[model samples]
Target: MITDVEWATFVPSALLLAATPGANQLLTLRNGLRHGLAPAVSASLGRFSAFALMVIAVAAGLGAVLAASEVAFNVIKWCGVAYLLWLGARTVLAAVRGQVAGEMQKTADEGDGKGVRGGLSSWRLGWQEFLVAATNPKALILFAVFLPQFLPRGAKDVAVPLLVLGAAYIRIEFCCACGYAALGSRLQSMGISLRARRWLDALTGVAMLGLAGWLATENH
Candidate 1:
């Protein structure tokens, strides 16, 4: 069991890490602008779900295997890079066509009576976010190292401690995601012109591509 003192020490660090801007937060921001708050929240949930799975894998000692195997690491890394690149291309294409793009188009059409089309659905967005979060080597490494530090000295049962800390970390991350989503939604509601929205989309596409490039080139 994590003592109160340990939790006190962990919570601040967790909150700081969660609040730092990263791919997940950026994705949530994009979702909020393109889809709405609901979809953004869903995406956050998907990210947390993936993080939970990673935590479980670490607890089960898979993290060691993954860290040690270059082939496995490269496979997951390439998959993530590919997905990000694909998503970036689609976003850029949608911007060029002046369409919402993805599943959000349907929702936007229904809500606003506008026929803006293209892009992925909320569920698909969530799933993609899940994939992004799951295949991240940094996250895997963090779990493998970070979680154990909080474990009580001489703790025999490791899984429970990991789950508890993981839950807390997820909660913090979810809150940060909500905050970013809400901020994005507010920006969306500011009545920007179609041209400006298109520009935003372009920027998002560039950001995604940049992330993909970083992932591909980063040293493991």
Candidate 2:
């Protein structure tokens, strides 16, 4: 188990990493834009639930095996890379097609759900976030490597402390997702010019593309 002093450092560290931009946050932003904040925030539970499973995997010693086995690690890494590339391309294409802005603006102005809903249900949103977090090898690395540093030395049961830290981290991560979703919701509420909305979406899409590159090149 972690002591109070360890908890102090762990909380801030978890918050810092939680706030770091990544695929989950990107999905939250997209969901908020397409749906609404409430559904987006609720759907984010799917991502953190995947994180919880990863912590369990780390506790069961599977994480070490993945880290040691290059093939397995590469499998997960490539999956994440592929998924991100697809998401980025889709988003960028939507923005670039130049057909959404006007329709979306009108929808926003009229308080209609047509442009916002996009026929995306909460369960679907949840499932997508789950896949994004589950497929990310770096997230497993965080639990397997970074989290252990905060554990009490010589503890007979390692799983408990890891679970505690994972729970805390999940809370913080959820909060971070909420903030991102909030921003997207705010943008939608503004009913700004079509150009502004289009630009914002384009920037997010480009950022996702850049993140994909970074993830592919990042040291495992």
lDDT by residue for model 1 (59-92), tens: 8888888889999999898988898888888888
Q: Per-residue lDDT for 31 in model 2?
A: 66
Q: Which candidate ranks first by lDDT, i.e. highest? A: 2
* Model 1, TM vs. native: 0.86
Best by TM-score: 2
Structure candidate 1, residue pairs in collision: 101-118, 101-119, 102-118, 102-119, 102-120, 103-119, 103-120, 103-121
For each candidate in turn, give its C-alpha RMSD to the true structure in angstroms.
3.4, 2.4
TM-score of every prediction relative to native: 0.86, 0.89
Which whole-number lDDT from 0 to 100 does residue 17 have in model 2? 90
Summed over model 2, clashes come to 0
